[model samples]
Target: MTPPELDRKSALFLDLDGTLLEIAATPEQVVVPPGLPSLLAHLHHQLEGAVAIVTGRPLAQTDELLRPFSASAAGEHGVSLRYADGTREELPAGIAVPSAWREELEAAVQRWPGVLVEPKPHGFAVHYRLAPEYGNEVWRLVRQLVPPEHPWFHLVPAREAVEIGLRSASKGHAVERLMAHAPFHGRRPIFIGDDFTDEAGMRKARELGGIGLRVAEVFGGDPANVRAWLMEGAQRLDGRSASSIPTGVTP
Candidate 1:
């Protein structure tokens, strides 16, 4: 067992869905666990601004979900950055997503049953949870619409669906970029997440001599694995605390 230590140079990386918030059928319907903002704020202050939420969701969505606390966020894998300093940065200027492609992808998904296509300011996504069988078909059409010239756009495969976003971003890249900045930089990276996309950040965090806590869900497969991982991670965090672990659950 790894002995817990109060390392001042520790940067905590967390994933929103299945980490800070529970995953839902639609991205828009997710519930923000009560007191999560406050708990994150406490963690942020305790870690001296070494806390960050690295997720596949868009940066703006992550910000909106973690209202009040708005801890540093890396969205769309890591292509976008929103720092504590109140600045948001996107990838290179040349990689702007063309509107035509967005509409094309949206139209393509509309024709497929159980496929929910959403438009992002930068890219697009095709949700196939309702029609899991169409997963590969959705990817085929999406791939046809995307050209290799767009260096910032790529497809990210999740549990039940595939998301197309800026290619330049990822959880691992976000962690690297965040650590290069103040407070987050120069700290040991402790990443917790429950998704295939999060593996990059986890691997990177371990390479940096920090811990990668995998949260597992109680049911389901991989997502469940993430929920379980988080439960243990929370316990680990609780055990090291001088005080009791603050429950986000309201009595």
Candidate 2:
């Protein structure tokens, strides 16, 4: 089926790594190709400031890369949110994982070479991308640290990493919350992502009367395709004539 075209009423929610940017050995290693920020800025204007980056990384990290061209954003899988007006909100108080757990997790993952423990204000992640062979071992260790039955925390496994965080946070809830506010409200939501963590946003988008586009085998499973798609859509939104739109390779 042909994908839906973005229009005036569309609100776009996008994932970062693997969707907008190519997945890297480590989260910090991901590259933001030239023109991406400008493209996002164009779409944000086209959509009337309804564009957002819903990512697993922190808003600070997202800002670090997308500075001077910010839009709405939900970071740490919805642990926090920032609107176009620059207002910020976070999961209610008392939802953070205990400091002791963070300390323990940090010390435990050191045994495995190439394994990195990234600490967030609300949770922590164990990345084994550099040491894919240790994926199972990393999961096993994380499971022990944050058992499945834990009341306040749960595990989110994605790519080659496992994140343990507050049970109240998720990409779906983030989308729902943003849609209830200005700009996003009354718009059909379109979410695009490329990983398991992105599925929640996808479902929420469809439920809210839009669609989810996946960057998998069909789209070459790469960020270039996503950029190309956005470029075409941006051109269309800009009212560029069909003949003037670049007929580049499909993603």
Candidate 3:
């Protein structure tokens, strides 16, 4: 696939799992290439600190995965945030899911040996990738625990998992919040993501006069390809990499 253009005038928002990192069997098994952090850092610097990470993972877990490098980030699908200035948006209390829900999720998954309960700071997820036969049951149970009409919670469906998080937290809102700040306010936004949760952010990017790219449709469903395209774009932006920029093209 042809790499998307990125220049200093672009404000880039990226999704983590399934976009930057391959989705592992378990969340803890995902791997980050040795050069990914540096690649992201270079892009961040080239774009004048306009890059941001928006994901469903918690802020602390994001930090742990991308350690030794930092950028503006939205976590738990925007339930938490860390802006370019190093300050974070304080979350209001009583928004977290009930502890009973977590226990129920954990106990319910026991019926299917391979299904699992993944705990998060503000919420939790039920994964049944290994136990595909139990997918429907897992979904039904989770949906029953956190109903679709719930005032404060939402059930976010993913590749082989479903997440229970705050209804108010969404990637679309995260993009809007990030775009309101310096370095990103006037720049063209390019959001790239891989799942249903990312659709909101993608739509927001397009709505605000920017580009939204889907990994499956645009990059053939491979995070490695996304990384390669990003590297090429960063090189084009920085004018210091091995990538040869088109003589008359504006990137």
Please write out the lDDT profile of model 1 over residues 181-211, one tens digit for every residue.
8888777898878788888898888888877
Error of 2 at 168 (Å): 0.6
Error of 1 at 169 (Å): 1.9
Candidate 1, residue 53: Cα displacement in angstroms equals 1.0
How many clashing residue pairs are found in candidate 3?
Answer: 0
True-structure RMSD, every candidate: 3.9, 2.9, 4.1
Can you tell me which runs of candidate 3 are displaced by over 4 Å?
1-3, 90-93, 243-251
Candidate 2: pairs in clash: 225-251
Residue 225 lDDT in candidate 1: 42
For candidate 1, give the lDDT: 0.71
Q: What is the TM-score of each candidate against the true structure?
A: 0.81, 0.92, 0.93
Error of 1 at 244 (Å): 6.7
Error of 1 at 126 (Å): 0.9
**Candidate 2 or 1, higher TM-score:** 2
What is the C-alpha lDDT profile of model 3 across 123-235, one tens digit per residue? 88888888899998988888788776888888999989999988877899989988999868998889999999999999999998998999999989999988888878877
Tens-digit lDDT track of model 2 for 33-142 = 76788778877888899999999999999988876668899999998999878899898555777788778767766777898988887888889889998898888777
